[model samples]
Target: MPAQALATLNPETEEQDRRASVINELEEDESVDEVEHSTQRGAPNTGTTPANAAAQPDIGILPSGQTQPSAPDTPVAANVDLNDVVTAPESELLAMQLDTLPMPRPAQPLALLGSEVLPGTSARLAWSPGIQIPGLSQPTPVLAVNGIHAGPTLCLTGAVHGDELNGIEIVRRTIYDLNAEELSGRVIGVPIVNLPGFQQGSRYLPDRRDLNRHFPGSPDGSLADRIAHSLFENVIRHCDMLVDIHTGSLKRTNLPQLRADMNNPDVATFTQGFDRMAVVHSSGSPGMLRSAAVAAGIVAVTLEAGESHRIQEHQIEAGVNSLTSLMEKQGMTSRMFVWGDPEPVYYDSDWIRAQHGGILFSEVDLGAHVSEGEILGYVADPITNAQYPIRANSNGRVIGMAVDQVVMAGFAAYHIGTEAEIPAE
Candidate 1:
């Protein structure tokens, strides 16, 4: 064979082939989610599932034997110090949500976490002076920030889904040739929150925990929760602001946008500043890192960049520019951060899903404008090739689109950001 033909035949020689394999691995991992989903659907007691049904309270476990002690034995306290209640034992605090949070022991080589860590200032709480996750050959991620000048604590975390590496790219690039002295506060970038999942290219950790859902996590929950708790407690607790970075995982693409809870009185103000924002209205899901920040009263927002687990230059550029703009917005940096092309299309949006299981064929690109009744996409039977048109029920901009041509019944095929529009010239 000719030299050109031989080169083409060599899988190890092509960088694109490696990337393609990585993408395939991500896709396969998502397939595992489908299996678990199928298990839930097929379970005989699906009604008992908390996901499928409203959770019932354990009324039976209430204090049944307790006598009526409404008033304390010593009914004297008119002016007792409230500090008694304010500064309770960690044991008591831990018991309140005993079953939920991380229960991690201090690393055996507790010294593994550096001995004297400089917890950053209030504004840059997430930027710990220095620490380490022991056992890992890598000099833990904490030390990555050492010697960096104090600045606003801007946390740009990515790949919480493991496969979504777009945000990682943003964080990696922002730090390249960065000058701490030039920054006013701090930038705490956990480019990959779910390191194990990222390594496996899976969404959840090995223990099946969704790190995103476990918020304000306990120091004693699952591994993911523990890590999250450690992260929040040791990192974000001090920051005045946080920006979580993410990409559309599971074969979907989201237009570069901000997903924040417009309903949050504290958070709504900043995330909404951008021109193209997709307000998720999610203050905090139980395990989500962002929600934990929200509860902690930190100004936090999650930015959706692009497709999952891959480095798209435009996406990275968009993310970097957005982060810089956000930093400047908060008066952290002097860098000129440009707003995205097209004034941000603001919206309170929801998903339009497939009603019947079929293959999803999209008619529009993410970020494309659409009218009511427009053919946003079509769901077709794979074997029969019979098409079921998925139309837009309301006028909106497409914030997300399914990357997979195949989808199932009730699968979210498209997400429309309503009340958004291209800026007028």
Candidate 2:
């Protein structure tokens, strides 16, 4: 039976059936010691059945698309001191509705990152890493849009690696299109997380550190560590969910897709919510924002789109649509937005590297499906005009590829995702 249909069944009957199944399993078991231990632990004797457990009252939707019962009018977490989080004026809180979704509550003030952002208001807060130059100090911008009604706090962060421009624009547009009065929960956006690297148009910090490799930061550690610690403690720790956006580095472009730890059922639902993008199951590297946030018990996912340093309109638009769809799925907005056709979900992916050094060109675009032994592109020696065809080693879709440019032997040129058949070496 469909999980959605099962969710609507009588809860009492379901529990009774579950108990009966446990009893049958216990009766059939021949191990006396195991049975005695199970009896003492009050454990179910049968292997657990996969069932759609009753959804939490606070969470709005199930993975099966069924709506959960509305929660009672409970106050926000008392532990979250709202005094530091600012609140907007009543007039501003009631300003305008950007969508048709019903508001869950009147706007209320919330505080974050040492600033108070009122309900129905959008504000840009700043964070400085305490690194002062001769006459200049750079402060990273943290954008917040608090909704009139109450809902889970969703944080959208971008440009962790300064040159990843697609995410910066994605976060900006996603927050810009929202109307505070119409929104149900809060949306926090950090468009440029690596200010110094972004200013330099580089992928690493001025100190030559990859800012992304340090998380849950240390106050007494290096510059990167301090910045990470500050953001994690002051901003990320407050979010109920997070979407860390990125782009391919080093002249590579990625198809608009999701790289997430789908092993987590909640994370899997979040990935599936972005209907039109491909999903690559990944736990992510240590110190990554996605990994750290998940470890802190926040549901998080990463969205990779296009190449670094330049904004691709198609990729940006796709990201915005996917995020908006996700908000709608979470009941954070009443907007009626439908995602296009679904994309493939791959459990594994590999990169095809160049065997010879030369100027390069691609025959296929990002997101194109290719067959085993198919010609993907060619590497040409500029002076000699010698062309070498690049072929796919296995059947798969092109999730990422290097832009047309000079290349070196062993340079990763194409990233292919496949469900079966290992690529030929």
**Model 2: per-residue Cα lDDT over 1-425, one tens digit each:** 46574565547676557656766776888998887665423434465633444321134445668776644555655676666855566545566443455635675787887789998898988877676573787678888999988888999999999999999999999999999888888999999999888989999988899878899779999988988998899889989999999999999999998888877877877776786888887888998999999999999999999999898999999999999988988878878786687676777789999988999899998889899999999999988898988899999999999999999899999999985321110
Candidate 1 has its poorest 10 consecutive residues by lDDT at: 52-61
Which residue pairs collide in model 2, if any?
85-110, 85-111, 86-111, 86-116, 87-109, 87-118, 88-118, 101-334, 217-229
lDDT of each: 0.64, 0.84
- Cα lDDT of model 1 by residue, 257-326, tens digit: 7777666656766764554345554445655777778777788888888887677888777777666667
The whole-model C-alpha lDDT of candidate 1 against the native structure comes to 0.64
Q: Which candidate number would show the highest lDDT if scored against the true structure?
A: 2
Best by TM-score: 2
Q: How far out, in Å, is residue 187 in model 1?
A: 1.4
Model 2 CA lDDT for position 222: 90
Q: Residue 348: error of model 2 in Å? A: 1.5
Cα error, residue 337 of model 1, in Å, equals 4.1
